[model samples]
Target: MRRMKVEQAAQVIDRPVYKAALIDFLYQLADDELFLGHRDSEWLGLAPDIEEDVAFSSIAQDEVGHATLFYHLLSELGEGKADDLAYSRPAAVRRNARLVERANGDWAYTIVRHLVYDIFEDVRLEALASSSYAPLAHGAVKIRREERYHLLHMETWFTRLGQAGGEAKARVERAVAAVWDDLGDLFSLGVHEAHIVAEGILPVARDELVQRWEARMKPLFEAAQLAWPGAPHPAKEDGRLGQHSADLDALLETMGEVYRIDPHARW
Candidate 1:
């Protein structure tokens, strides 16, 4: 597909159905990063090791930055200011996958979670890097560079923890079990999945992305000596459709607290 500027794409997708699909797609991308970044930042002063603390902090910042970029793109489409779009939305309206919205658990949980999420993000961004929406494609190229490091960092920890052959391995296994069920919806394209594909906003099919994600993780799981948690069950409520857990509600309360106190304050 030939790349087109946002304005050019807008002209082509003048119909409401196409426009709405594009917006929904962008929201899913932006919300995932924003929520996960917030979750990751929870480890700022709490990571097990100082180096990991610093590394995770940096990764968190990058995820937030990526969210900001996507939000800005949405703003260009007349959504609202990026900050308002990000902070003012209720949890019921957020489109991040359940995997990202769930609270960070133990260090092993965090490692496994990051491993799973980073692989998905890597695949998603690779697909987006060639998106017909030119600006998003450009942004994807930049974000994927930083994301590569995140994948490496998680993989290193994943392998080490798996090979440690003690409590660490057991903990990671437990974490995997806890999150496995919710993994099914991670690649869901929501209600307008077909329209989004037809409009060229998502260059790759959702199923293909899932396949790539699994392929990428298979070797990592093996090297880590971890069993692949087979076939995830459908989540009772998926975030793509704006259904979320109480954990997301709590997270939004904290995340938007400062903004709500004074939405106009410059900071």
Candidate 2:
């Protein structure tokens, strides 16, 4: 694909019922992908193996693409330019959960994050694929088509690292345990959530969505001998509700540096 494709931006929904909620939903979607893409971009030249490096780069590119799509939607709503919204927001103002911004750590942690985040993203995207808002549903469909490869690549690593003896297994297990506490934050809907649900843009209940995610991921974790995380940590008191870790601060500095230099300059 080209560096970026201006696939038609989502059509404007003029009805008040859908308007604010959809915009908020779009921002959440855009923010999550933008931060995750930034995290992935950091790994461009740092992956363990060359073939793995190449495969990961493709996934990173897709994340960037997904961010661009939602950015365009936000731009159309007059919420500043897409790049500014992505790269100029204050760290606390960023809507992404801390999980997406956490450093990939060692190769094992990177793979662990990859497996966890990608699986969750796949579940969310599948839900979005059926969005009540036609444009979003369409965009989700297109994006999910590319997401299959991303999920597969990560799944393969999860299996390899899980079944591998000694060091690799220990690494993955530790990383998984570390991230389990923050997983629910990924599914959080913020203050604008009532409007989002009432507006029918994302029709599924949050718990149901999480359950679906669990169902989808359970088998993969079982096969790898990795335990699925127990208990749900609500985002209300969690780092996802604009309450983030220091890791987010570091990420925003790097992610926003280029855009903040001259927000008007065409890159």
Candidate 3:
């Protein structure tokens, strides 16, 4: 299929089914970045070292920027202003994977989580870079460029933590176990999987993308001498389906607190 620019896609999306599917796909992309970026921002002045704090701050900013880009695309589709879509939505309406919604635990947990999330994001964005939806494809290209740095940074930390042995290795191992169960939702497309794929918004199938994500991560896990955590179980509440954990509720409450206070007031 020929790539359709945002305007062209919007015209075709006059079909209700296509419009709903496109919106669902975009929300999944945008919410994941927004939630994870917010989680990363929690580390602002609290990262392990001064240098790492600076690096992580930059990464958080990038993730939020990526989220903003996706949200703007959603706004063009008439979902409302980007900030409103991001900050005003309730947890039940969010589309981010459960993995990102979990609270950041220790530095070990944070590092492992970042590594896992970035791997999945890397694959997802690669697929989007060729999306039949032109705006998403263009945005993916730019986001993926920045994501490369995130991947490198996380991988380095993952390896360092894994090889640190003793307490560090043990901590990372525990984090892996804690996070492994929720990973399945990263590939989930909810009930709209068929429509999203059928609409050709995402050129790759969800299963194929998941496979590619695992393939890329296996070697890295081995190199780090960490046992692959095996397959992830289905999420208890699928985030793609708008079913989320209480963690998300608390997160949204905090994230939107100031915005909700006076949404109309300029920041």
Candidate 4:
């Protein structure tokens, strides 16, 4: 049976398991955006070319803005202020995939990983657009508009690197191999995944999400004439479970440095 829409946060108040599942899913969504946005910002003034530097900076801003939107949704559910939620969480409670926490390697790695993750986000957002939770579905519809441009930007780079061949092709392929390990966790929805799906918060299961992402990548692969890397293998540590790399710790320290000094200070 199709689940009825949850029109508001107050509708979820009496359902503990369902509400918890919803909260966990929101954390994953918010954290991934925050981490990846931070990574993109690191390329500010350091991108391979001036135009690319500006473009990446803009994308970073978009991603962080998206994170703020998700955190705001959490705040509506009584999760606390959006600023504190993004900057104050310990690594153990974060639900983002470890892939986002990784350091941006060379340009090729950044291109490959960002494109790969964007493809996954495309799949995830499509699912969310129809989420039984009405607010989330509406929000996803808004996010997808901006994300389409992001996907286009990354796909352009991914194909450019692949078709360039010679040194460029070699580097992109190597980055693909390196990034595959982290890709495994990209579809995971944490410990509450079953409940989340059961509650119709995401509607799509993990395996289906991965399948859709892989299918979507085919055209890009063909355009670049790149070989399939097969399915991504899971990382040994599960970021969905709050397990994360030291890289995330360093990221939090830096990202929250100012906020920590004065949690109550207006931004």
RMSD of each: 1.7, 5.2, 1.6, 1.0
Better of 2 and 3 by lDDT: 3
lDDT of 4 by residue, 1-267 (tens): 578789999999998898999999999999999999999999998999999999999999999999999999999999999998999999999999999999998999999889988999989999999898899999999998999999999999999999999999999999988888888778888899898998889998888998899899888989998999888786577899998999999999999998988999976
TM-score of each: 0.95, 0.90, 0.96, 0.98
The collision pairs in model 2 are none
Model 1 lDDT per residue over 118-180, tens place: 999999999887777778888999999989889888999999999998999999999999778
In candidate 3, position 102 carries an lDDT of 91
Q: What is the lDDT of every predicted structure here?
A: 0.87, 0.75, 0.87, 0.92
- Work out how many backbone clashes candidate 2 has: 0
1-267, model 3: which lDDT tens digit per residue?
554444455575567877888889899999999999999999989998999899888888999999999999888888899989999999888899998999999999998888999998888888877776778888999999999989998899898888879999999999999888788788898778887776678877887987898898899888788999876776677899888999999999999999988999876
Better of 2 and 4 by TM-score: 4
Better of 1 and 2 by lDDT: 1
Model 2 C-alpha lDDT per residue in residues 10-115, reported as the tens digit of each score: 4444455456667767877887787777777787778887876777777777898899998887777778777778777776766776678788787778777777
Candidate 2 deviant stretches above 4 angstroms: 1-17
